[model samples]
Target chain A: MDEINLQRQSSTNDELVLIEEFFAQLTKPKNLDSIRDKAREFCQRNSHLKIALVTSGGTTIPIELNTVRFVDNFSAGTRGSASTEYLLKTEQYAVIFLFRHKSLEPFWRHFSSDELFSHLDVNPETNQVTVCPSFQPKLKEVISEQKKSENRLLKITFTTLSEYLFTLRELTMVLNELGSKAMLYLAAAVSDFYIPPENLAIHKIQSSEPLRLHFELVPKVLRPLVKFWVPDAFVISFKLETDENILLLKARNALKRYGHKLVIANELNTRKHKVTLVTEIDSESIQINSQNDEIEIEQLIVANVVERHNQFIHDQSSR
Target chain B: MDEINLQRQSSTNDELVLIEEFFAQLTKPKNLDSIRDKAREFCQRNSHLKIALVTSGGTTIPIELNTVRFVDNFSAGTRGSASTEYLLKTEQYAVIFLFRHKSLEPFWRHFSSDELFSHLDVNPETNQVTVCPSFQPKLKEVISEQKKSENRLLKITFTTLSEYLFTLRELTMVLNELGSKAMLYLAAAVSDFYIPPENLAIHKIQSSEPLRLHFELVPKVLRPLVKFWVPDAFVISFKLETDENILLLKARNALKRYGHKLVIANELNTRKHKVTLVTEIDSESIQINSQNDEIEIEQLIVANVVERHNQFIHDQSSR
Candidate 1:
């Protein structure tokens, strides 16, 4: 009876995840072609396929222009995108990249776009275009999203903090239904505070001078994962530093705050790329580096990320 | 009076926020070249400039790939380039662009060299190159770090998230030393987590198996306010998103995170370009829509950002 109930639950959950084409199409589209390619390359060749769900990009507080409200930052999506790409290079487990906006497109295009410079604009005055004067943004850069339908290396795009929150929440819900098939990579640049607009019209209509906006902290996404969501699942969360210039201080605090599997941290003005991976629950932290003259930073990041995913897969298989 | 401090602060702050070049090759440079251009156009006259601060290119994370360990990203320093042009557009702020790689000239030429693409291999039978159209690694997209003295833009090319953090830190330090005013816009994609391999031995590195990389988050350099480093300043940040999802969540989240006085949030992929001007604590958030044409999201962002700065000035004058 227990097994039967679990099976039914899984069926319903997959339907919900797959059925919501609106969420995928309207805001972010899943890169089916890439996913199919990934599926073919990684899963077909290697039977044991595990995945680390990685997310990146910035968040925002929604408010209108006429009414003085809200705050936000432009995260180039470097960490999240870099980490996801790095994890994929492992070839151990296929990666599920869930991201939002301009940050992820470049990576996908970099990997898939046939030519370079296809996206860059040309100057009318100098008549100069393309970075290399040779490479172009690739005519095939905008290959229809259709091509990626069968791909296993799928990248789902998203924008706005709430969209990401909903995404995380929904994915977590699916994970419970799937009975823990994948690990969670909590590297998304989620905003600490969110402003719940009191009244939409009143706020927008009352435009005299500078308006005031109030906010409160959003609920913790990862803490619940270990506590309520899924105790057995592997989890990793990111901690950004602003106050205590100390790197470990921030990472330690993050581990305590989220209770994830690992926490990564770096310091300011490091000439070369650097990251500190802090393992939660008593395991020692590992330091990863990408050299100034070595492999690109993003690939290295993906590599480590995948290694973690593989560890989980091996551990689960052992069990 | 309070009003006097605001305007005086605006002018005084402008000096430090603008770029400063001490290469000694150029006699003098101006500040905020875009604003200067506007001033000149408004007066329809010529204005002699003194100093130009050039911030060039985007950050590169030099990670080692396949033992050779060289890789890069898609930042062309176009935004910074436009910023320089805008500075020169005004002739008010001598333009000095601290740019990243691939965004400048000599560096661009370096990429065009045959030596760079010599690695491209072709099959004699098929006449098809293994990595055709472009064989060079993506990192070559990074702009060169070399600079010329006479250039109006002061370009500072960098790669890797660490380098970006370092460059900004050093630049701000220099600004403090010279007491240069500035209109600093927080643009460019900075990598967050890096492989923290500061102490890894080169020979000990294993090539075959997956390398377990632990990453720790890096600290933000902008933490130390320019007021402390280079007092009296103009600073602006960029935020991008799509409107198909939830805009309010994004808008409010951004305001809370960076604490920027003004945020320029736009919805792409829509019939009309919609931009919301956000502030930390403002009288109101203004939403601007222009279905008619592309009115310059870049400039519009700059203007809204400037409005806050202008408000500071206006309040100063009133006082």
Candidate 2:
């Protein structure tokens, strides 16, 4: 099929059939009920506080049932982890960090993905390895903050796209009672295409021949998430584009279709340096500067998001 | 085309044209000449030492030029890292580890992939973080061993399949003079198919539509390595299978076709527990037992391979 025809087919199929098929075919994540129970308890315990579910990293979609190979998005979980740190710094919200397995985490993102051996001073004479003195202050800060928020933060990991979708749905259902008090900072780079369960190869794909893979567009889950699952929650999504020309338009389209509160739009090259916050009413650009290098752009993003959430809560109470 | 036709086409095209096309189209890895120079220097300095080039982890194949998504093989570098330890235990060879980026390394593979925070003892009041005492001995051993081998082990990392092929060819040529003294342990899980340079999408593959990807079979590089690059090197390849029934047959076929010294055949479920050493004449099944629970299976695998290499060296001298 032509590219235009294929796009039309996918967008049309996305409306209802795709989402319904996805849920119907998807096997629930293992131990999901117990996780839901725990989330329920967490919500009940922290009724007075706002809870934010921040998703990070890239999800995988296995082409084989006994997956020796899979497709993956390019993400390091920098944005989500950074935002979580900023949110915690405010001390205003409890976080449920649903992240891709082995991706970066809050406070830990400062370190490079090398062996911890490099950060330690190994004294052969004494047979002791200790954290280097230069890194001590940051380590102390991270540990102290972590210890203080031990009960407030929950981390859940998923490697596959299917597991991520299932876990997300279950978490939202458990936190339904929190209503507008909850926020979804959707920063994960989720896979857009996946082989259907029935189509997945039973064995590792053999290397003896040419390969042709057919993938159906993953039915967009945002519609149900916004309309049905915790409908009153202040939801924020992300739009990552390489082209500057289509960035704002795509972000606006997503906000209109999903009926979410905000869309954080970023070009691939400038994502770390600048981002535009496209809300229903207006767009605001946030950028890093020479003075604010120590304080990341995420600090600004979180501040604006928190302010909007506060306004949203106020409007609900007034009504 | 039919499946049979596709297989035939791929196998026929793999002879010479594919390899030429791949090299011509591939962007040379940055600093490859410097790396080759270093390898030559290493060989000259350690001329008396038996050198083994051990490949580890998984290689990626980008679908687009600006890759937002890519296909990847499933490997954590466990086998390669574990084998490296065994090879070092013999105290006979210098190692050049060509590995996938962020995958495991020797000695450090003992630690889990989670944040190192869990392994630390954090004193919130004192504002200090220290490595937990119980894990001290292993950490010391790893660090000391690493320090001792600082000059012996050379690590080169690759993320993409094209880079891997380029690096491998260069390394093999540099080590060509070592002849039967050199061993090539091929353990890395490589992607079987890739979108050729001419066909790759310029931008990220948009998810707005059902996506059908066409991949050409990656040309087999083993033939050139065996016959042309380092013809007299003691070569061993791995055959990882999910099915037990066909494992031995596939391993035997690879040995026959490539004229390699050995093929280490393994079933995915039992790879860590058992492996079959398929040689030119016979297949030997090696299994782990309770008596040797403290020792890894790789120690045994490496021992057998080392014995064979010794015999080969002896045979070469006699001739």
Identify the CAPRI category of the predicted complex in candidate 2: medium
- Candidate 1 Cα errors over 4 Å, as ranges: A1-48, A65-70, A104-150, A177-180, A199-211, A243-247, A268-272, A281-293, A317-319, B1-319
Per-residue lDDT for A143-210 in model 2, tens only? 77777776777888999998899989999997677878899999999988988889989998888888
**Model 2 has how many clashing residue pairs?**
0
The lDDT, on a scale of 0 to 1, for candidate 2 is 0.85
Task: Kindly list the per-residue Cα lDDT of model 1 for residues B88-164, writing each as its tens digit.
Answer: 44435554445565354323332432233333333357533333435333423332122222233444455445555
**Per-model TM against the reference:** 0.44, 0.91
The worst-scoring run of ten residues by lDDT in candidate 1 chain B lies at B19-28
RMSD, every candidate, angstroms:
15.0, 6.4
Pairs of residues at least 3 apart in sequence or in different chains that clash in candidate 2 = none
Q: What CAPRI-style quality would you assign to candidate 1?
A: incorrect
Supply DockQ values for each candidate.
0.04, 0.55
Deviating ranges (above 4 Å) for candidate 2:
A1-18, A113-115, A289-293, B1-18, B113-115, B122-128, B289-293
